[model samples]
Every structure is written in structure tokens, then in C-alpha cells.
Target: MKTRAVRMYGEMDLRLEEFELPEIKDDEILVKVISDSICMSTYKLAKQGKKHKRAPQDIDVNPIITGHECSGVIVQVGEKWKDKYKVGDKWALQPALNYQGKLDSPGYSYRFCGGDATYCIMPHEVMELDALLPYDGEAFYQASLGEPMSCVIGGYHANYHTNKQNYNHAMGTKKDGNILIMGGCGPMGLGAVSYGIRFENKPKRIVVTDVDDAKLERAASVISPEFAASKGVELIYFNSSKENAEEELLALTDGHGYDDVFVYVPFKPVAEMGDRLLAFDGCMNFFAGPTDNQFKSEINLYNAHYTSTHILGTTGGNNDDLLEALQLAAKGEINPSVMVTHVGGLDAVADTTCNLPGIPGGKKLCYTQFDMPLTAIDDFEELGKKDELFAKLDESCKAHNGLWNPEAEKILFAHFNVEI
Candidate 1:
């Protein structure tokens, strides 16, 4: 079949072109893409190119696609996968395809596969590992959001603290303890906040801190302090740009310290601040992936040793995490839709990804079949004055108080002449 995709040749080099996909082998499955959400990691990979660990090393001869967060429908099934996945079934892909420790992933490793493309082929490894998941949700974007949500869940699972009694250790977040999320206004941080507040282990309280009050306000509105309070979970948003922000947070915890801290940004000053604020037996998760190969920051190793405060970092989620994210979304425990802030089409992915860092918002969702440019929900009202399509989209989103929902997605796809 003739397919079109955005391929990455090198850093600052991405091209959207048409190519023919070879017939799939018996172990492969052909999928038609639905929705793809642009992740900040894709921006880092696009800029870093060959320097990225998960990205393929070869360039001029063998370029790869450039999107990991995506959703699709099974259009053709191989003989081997026929019983497991049939045509017309919705599916999601977990990008962390650790094939014998080889640094190969769908978007970064395969030329005929990527979330930003019109179509993608699920190769043998993806099927065998059960990474190509069957999705039962009505909203296709939920599948795309699954990958990132899984990363958040994995961070919480990977966190651990030493047991003072046995001098052994305990993994996962402190059960029924206080939790702090640094820079929690961002998309990923917001997911952590939502997941943390309703974690099965049940935290006693959660405080999300950020530098900008406006972002915090928006975060509060999205997550809703009132909702958290109604659920009997204390969710507080604090502006930490002030000089006394640390003191205020310490005071909130009665000067003891937070039980768990999830740091979303890797800035040296902020990272060091996160380090110093760790309590005895506290687990600090440096969740953000660093671009610099030699990234360094000061850590109080003396306190780390004496207080048993340990620091850990994670790159991405495994298959189990991805499944958990989907399961949670299915059960109404977590809403992946809370992360989306902007919607666009395939053509806008290149620009949207290149300017992702400068752009401030949550997840940017792209519909592969549409021809629209990148449009933020905040700008939908303004754009409605010119484009009637956006006018309807503006009203649809406004009906839900400016949030992405299944109805809005249906309106967009129908207006764009794509089957929902």
C-alpha cells in the first residue's frame, strides 16, 4: 500500500513524504492510524536525532518515522495474528519495544511505522510482546495517551525507600503518606497528580507546586481542588517561585518533609531544590528525560546516606504500565482526556513538534485524516470568527467548558470529512 509519513533523517531534518509499504509478513499486522498525540519526548528525539538512545543510528540511507504516541485500527491481519487481532478492531501500541535490549522502537526504528503517518505496520516483535493492545474505549485518543500515563504509573511503581527496621527496602509510593509533585502544572505532572490523588495505595494528601500562579490556577481548574476535596483527598496547588516557597511547603508538612517527590523538570536549581526537600526515607523521582548526555546536578549525598533518601529516574513505561493505564481509564479511575490542550492534523505535526517547548499547554492531539493546522482550544473562539469548522468546534468544546471529549472529537472528524 502507498503510505505517507513524517520521517526523521537527522537533527532538524524531518520530511513528510509518500512511500509504498511492502506486503506484511505472516507475523506482522497492518493498521490504519486514527489519532496521534505529540509528546515532548518526540521533540527531544527530533532535535537530538541520532544522539537519542532509542532512535536509530543510521541516517542518510535509512531514515525512520517520528512519532511514538498514537492510536489505530487493525485493517489487515497476518495469518499468525488472525486469531488474536481481527480487522476493524481498535488497538494501541506501547513504544517501549525492548527487543533483546536493542534500541529499536516503532517511531524511531521503523520507516513504515509511526504515529504521525497515515498507516503503520505492527511488526513481529510488537505482536509477540503484546504491545499492540486491543482497545475497547470509544475515544481513540485514549490509546495515544496510554503510553504517557503508563510512564507516570511506572515512575510511582519504580520509586522505593529503605525500611528503617529491617534495613531492607520498600518499593512504590508510601502507602497512605503525603506526596509532592514538582512543576505539576505541566501535562505529565498533571497526570501524576490525578493518578496520585486516586492511587489505590491511597495517599493521605498531595501538594502540587509550580513557579507560575497562572499555570497553577489552570491546573486547579483542570484537576479541580473542589473535586479532590469532595473525594476526601487534599489536593493543594502552590506557587514556588517565591523565595520562601520552600519554607511554606515545609510548613505545610509540619516541617517534617514530603514522603514522595516527583520532579518533572531537570533544571539544575529546581533539581537541587527537590533534592534538599526530601524527607527521611523519601523517594525523589526525576521523571523528566534529560537531553544532555553529561547532565549533572548537586546532591546532598551525606543526607542521602544518613536519612536514607534515595533518588531514582525512569525513561519510559513497560507493557504492564501501558495496560494498567488503559485499564484505569476504562474503569473511570483516570481520565486521559485531561491532558489534551490542542488539536491539529498530520501536516501540523512537524511545526507543532519543533516548537513544542516554547508552546505552553498540555498534550497536543493530531488527527491524521484531517487537513487542519494546529489550533489550541483557547484560540478556538477566535478562530471561529473566520473558519466555520472551528466555530462548531469552539461551541462543542465550550459546551464541556473547553475540554476535549468524545463528542468534540466526533464533531471534528465529521466536519473534516473523516469517518468517526
Candidate 2:
């Protein structure tokens, strides 16, 4: 099969080219990738290339395709797995396959198996680890976003508090407790806030803070306070950039502090602020991954000694978390569309992935079968004036509160005369 994908040849060297894919082995499967969500990790990989642990050292000689967060339809099933999986089944992938302690993964290590392609092969290891998950959602973008949402779920699951009687650790967030999410207006941070409000071990109140007023406004609009009230949770958006913001934020909790605090940005001040806002047995989660190896933040050790305040960190989610993400999305309990801000085609993957950090907004979603530039949903109306395709897309998205949805995806595919 011939596939067009963005492949990494060396450090900061990415190419969009067409190539023939070798036939899938009996233990492998073939899929027609529909949608992929660009991640910052892919930007890091493009910059680091062979130096990355998951990237093969011989990438210059043998390039690997570069997208990971994707969802698609099974086109061909290998004989070895025909009984387990069949053609025409929708699927989502959990890419963090720490298989047998090996660092290699789909998007970083495989030549013919990645998301930035019209078609790709799934190796046997993916099935062996059960990383290829069955998805029955109407929208493929939801499955593509499941990977990031799962990481948010994992962070929530990783939080733990201590039992005073035995000094034992209790898993998960405290139920009916006050929660704080710092620097929470970006894509992942928005996911954290959405999940916290709908989570089973629900928080009584969720306070989300961010430095940018625009981001805070967008986050509030996407995940409204009315929605939180309907879910029996109190939601508040605070601007951390304001003077005496910390003091003002604390006053909202009646000076009791928070039972659970999450740091969504790698900024040291935010981390330290989260530490100071901890309640007696509060569990603080550092959710953002920093590029610096020596990233440090000051912690209130006095609270750790006198109270039961502690901290932990999570980089990604496990398989169980991905499953939960998929289940919640399918059930309409959580809207993954809130994370998506831009839409593009496979032609835009390389450039978008290479400069992801420079672009402001949330997830950049791409469809693998067409050619279109990366355009923000917020700018759809302006772009629509020049092209009817974007006009229809703008109409569809605007009908859904300026968020990407199944109707918008359908409109896009229909414009390209491509069947989903």
C-alpha cells in the first residue's frame, strides 16, 4: 500500500513524502487513519530526532512516521488476529506502550506505523500489549483526543492522601473535597478541569487559575459554570496574574485551603503556589512535564512534617485510563471537542508539528486524506468569506458553540468528497 506521511530524517528535519508500505505480517493489521491530534511531544521529537530515547538512531537511513495521537478504521486484519479484530471496526490507540521495558513506540520507532498517514500498518507488539483499542464513537476526533484525556485521568488517579491511623496512602482524589487546578486553561489543563467536575469521586468545588485572561475566558466558555452547577460542582475561574491573586484565591475557600491541588504548568511559581494552598492532607499533583532535567520547586516541608501534605507526578496514562476516556467520550459524559482549536489536513502535519509550541491555542487536529492548511476554528468565519468549505465548517462549528464536533468533521470530509 502507498501512504503519504510526515517522517523524521534527522534533528529538526521532517519531510512529507509518498512511499510504498510493505505488506503487513500475519500478526499485524492495517488501518486507514482518519484523524490525528498534534501533541507538543511530537514537536520535541522533531527537534531531538535520533537523540530521543524512543527514536531509532538510524533515522537518517530509515525514517519513521511522526504522529501518535490518532484514531481510525481498520481496513485489513491479519490472519493471525482475524478472530479478535475484523475489518471496518473503529479503533483508538494508547501509544505509551512500555512493553517489556522497551522505549520504542509507534509514532517514534516505526517506519510504516504512525498516525500522520492515509494508511499505516500496526505491528504485532501493538496488539500484544492491547494498545489498539476498539472505539465506537461517531466522531473519530474524539478517539484521537482520548490519548491526552487519558493522561488527565491518570493524573487524577495518581493523586493520593494519607491515613492518619496507619500512615498508609489512599489512592485517588478526596471525594466531596475542595480542588484547585493551577495554570489550567490550556488543552490538557481544560481536560483536567472537565474531568474533575464529572469524575465519580467528585469535588465539591473546583477552582481553575491561569495567567492569561483570554485563556481563562475561553476555558470558562467551553466548560461553563452552568454546566458545573448541573453536575453538582462549583466552578470558578481566577486570574493568577492579578495582584494578590494568591490571597484572593485562598479567600474563596474560606481559608481552609484545598484538599487537592494540581499544577498544570511547569512554571516554578505555580508549583510553589500549589504547595502553599494545600490543606491538611492535601495531595498535590504536578501534571506538566518540564524539559529541564533539573526542574525544581520549593515545597512547604513543614506541612509535610506536621500535616500529611505530599506531592506526586504523572507523565502519561496507562491502558485503563485510555479506556475510561473512550467510555466517557462515547457516553457523552465528557466533551473532547473542547481541547481542539485548529483543524488541518495531512499536508499540514509536518509544519504544524515542527512549530507546535509557537502556535497558541489548544489541540491541532488533522485529517489524513486531504490537503488543507492549519486554520483555527476561531478564525473560521474570516476564512469562510474566501472559501465556502470553511464557510460551512464555520456554520457547523458555530452551531456547536465554536467547538469542533462530528458535524464539522462531516462537513470537512464532504467538501473533499471523501467518505468517512
State which candidate has the highest TM-score: 2
Error of 2 at 103 (Å): 1.7
Q: Where does candidate 1 clash, by residue pair? A: none
TM-score, predicted candidate 2 vs. hidden true structure: 0.98
TM-score of each predicted structure versus truth: 0.97, 0.98
Query: In candidate 2, residue 35 scores what lDDT?
Result: 92
Q: Per-residue lDDT tens digits of candidate 1, residues 1-420?
A: 977788889887888788888999999999999889998888998889888877777864688878888888988999998888989899888988878878688887887788988887888999988989889987888889999999999998899877767866777899877788998888899899878877776677889988888889888888898888876788899998998988988888888788898989878877888888888888899987778878889999998879988898987899889999998988878878779899998898888888899988899999887667888899989989999878888898888757787888888877878763
- Models, CA RMSD each: 1.3, 1.2
In terms of lDDT, the best-performing candidate is: 2
Residue 73 of candidate 2: its Cα lDDT? 92
